[model samples]
Target chain A: MTLLTIVLLAVITFTTRYLFLHPSLPVKLGPKMVSFLNFSAPAVLTAIWVPIIFVHEGELNVNPLNPFVLSATIAVIISAKTKNIYWTVGVSLAVFVAMKFFL
Target chain B: MLTKKQATIKMIQKGIIDMLPLNLAVIPWGILCGSLAIQRDFTVLEALLMPMIVFAGAAQLVATELIAENAPLLTILFTVFIISSRHFLYGLALRQKLKVLPLKKRVALGFVLTDELFALSTDKKSLKGKLRLTYGVSAGFSFYFSWLFFNIVGIVAGAYLPDLTTLGLDFAIAVTFIALVIPTITSLPVLVAVCVSGVLSVVLKLMGWELDLVIASLVGMYSGYLTLRFTNQNQLNEPEK
Candidate 1:
């Protein structure tokens, strides 16, 4: 069962990646479609992070004391202020460790 | 004094070297994924196979989370499909550049395509024909190995260390993702898309929607598209104001 799950998931991932990559497919995305697809990165990132940061044990934990919330908030500020990925990840991780230590 | 083979090797080396810096992000992400898989009760063999077979960092992480919750197989498949759907866009974006390659080469390249690889490919000045192929393949291979290696490290570490979740290590994934998304929020439409998607996902999850991520992403994409259209029309209608 685990092997089946892994193989099927790989197939799905490969299919999406190969859908438009095939040389013989003759796929040409319209400008509107391109514009819509352009938002995929931010939209997907937001979708993934929201639950990770906001939810705890199937419940919404929005309090400021939530370590994930506080650390994530600091991560955002550091990310924006530095606009450097290394700093964003580094400083926020430090802040997260500090939060874990104190709270 | 360089032979043709030597020049090819040089280009491939350049590709790997250029990609090394991005490993900063990939390394941690891979380790976290490996550890998370183990924490979620994946056998070490299963954890290792996942990176080799699935080869997607974010999607694999999501899969581990869903598996921990014992979600239905169908739900896991559907959610992974939604998360990986973005790769379709990457393939679309690269179609023209890759069109000249043979079918076999195209398929091989597509198999290893990742967000970082795609970004690296597009961010460069044009390199035609064989050089492009060699460079891209080498870079992809470099990243692939680095990812797999770190997963092994994470698995070993997960085995020996105390539970990492207690140390808040899983939070690294969210931090990495936040770092990735922040630089992309350069315009109003993108900002709107992110905020809308973020809020909607939390709300949907709060409401017990298992597919909240998928739905929120689609809505966010549409909203961003609409915002851009509305902004364009307003500018057209009031060029003098």
Candidate 2:
């Protein structure tokens, strides 16, 4: 069952990726669809991270002392300011480690 | 100016080198995910093959967590599909730019398409010509191997260190996601979309919705689209100053 699930995962992911890129496929998207897709990446990413950052051990943890919140706050600011992944990740990880140590 | 072959080589090299920083960032999560999978009773071979085949760190992470809970196979597969469906948008975004390449190359490129590769290859300056294909594929291959390598290290180390999860290294995944998503909120509509989706996801999770992630994302996309249209309508309605 596990092996089957793993193989199916690969197939599903590859199909999602390959559908539009297939040279002979008749997949034509409208401009509105393209514009809407422009938001999917950010929206999907946000949805994924929010649960991890906000929920700890099945409870909501929104306090500043929460290491996830502090690190993510700094990460957001740095990512927006520098638009650099290295800085955003480096400093955020540093803050996360520091928070874990003190609190 | 360089010859065609020279340009191709240079672009491929650039792809490999350009992915170095992200590859580094991906290492911790990749290792952690490998360890998590192994801890979830995945055989060493299964842990290694998961990353190599799925090539999606985030989706694999989600899938493993569900597997740990002894979730149903259909549920796990559904969650992974929803998590990875974002790649559909990536394929659509790049199809035009990549259509110039032959069908075989296009298929290969699609197979390896990743968030990092999409970001790297879609930079405004490089979004042209066959060079994009060369660079995209090379970058994807580079990141893909690095991910698999990191997973191997994680699997080996996880075998000995049963408490790898206690180190709080999982926070790195959440933080990495923050860094990845923040820079992409380039406009007000995107901002609106992100906030709506994020808050809605939390709400749905709290309510114990079965497919909160998928539902939240669709709502978020719709909110963003509506915001864009609203902003445009406002501009059109405003009289010339």
Best by TM-score: 2
Q: What is the lDDT of residue B222 in candidate 2?
A: 86
Number of clashes recorded per candidate:
0, 0
Compared with the true structure, what per-residue lDDT tens digits does model 2 show for residues A1-103?
7778889989988988888877677877677876776677778767778888887666788897788888888888898899887898899999888878887
Query: Runs in model 2 with CA error above 4 Å?
Result: B62-76, B121-127, B166-168, B238-241
**Tens-digit lDDT track of model 2 for B5-74:** 9999998899888787778877787788888888888987778778988778778888888877989988
Query: How close to the true structure is residue B137 of candidate 1, measured as C-alpha lDDT?
Result: 86
Alpha-carbon error at B234 in model 2, in Å?
2.2
- The collision pairs in model 2 are none
| Stretches of model 1 off by over 4 angstroms after superposition | B1-22, B26-29, B32-46, B58-83, B92-100, B115-140, B165-167, B238-241
What is the CAPRI rating of model 2's predicted complex? Answer: medium
Per-residue lDDT for B54-76 in model 1, tens only? Answer: 99877898888887888899998
Model 1: number of backbone collisions: 0
**lDDT minimum window of 10 residues, candidate 2 chain B:** B118-127
- Model 1 alpha-carbon miss at residue B42, Å: 6.4
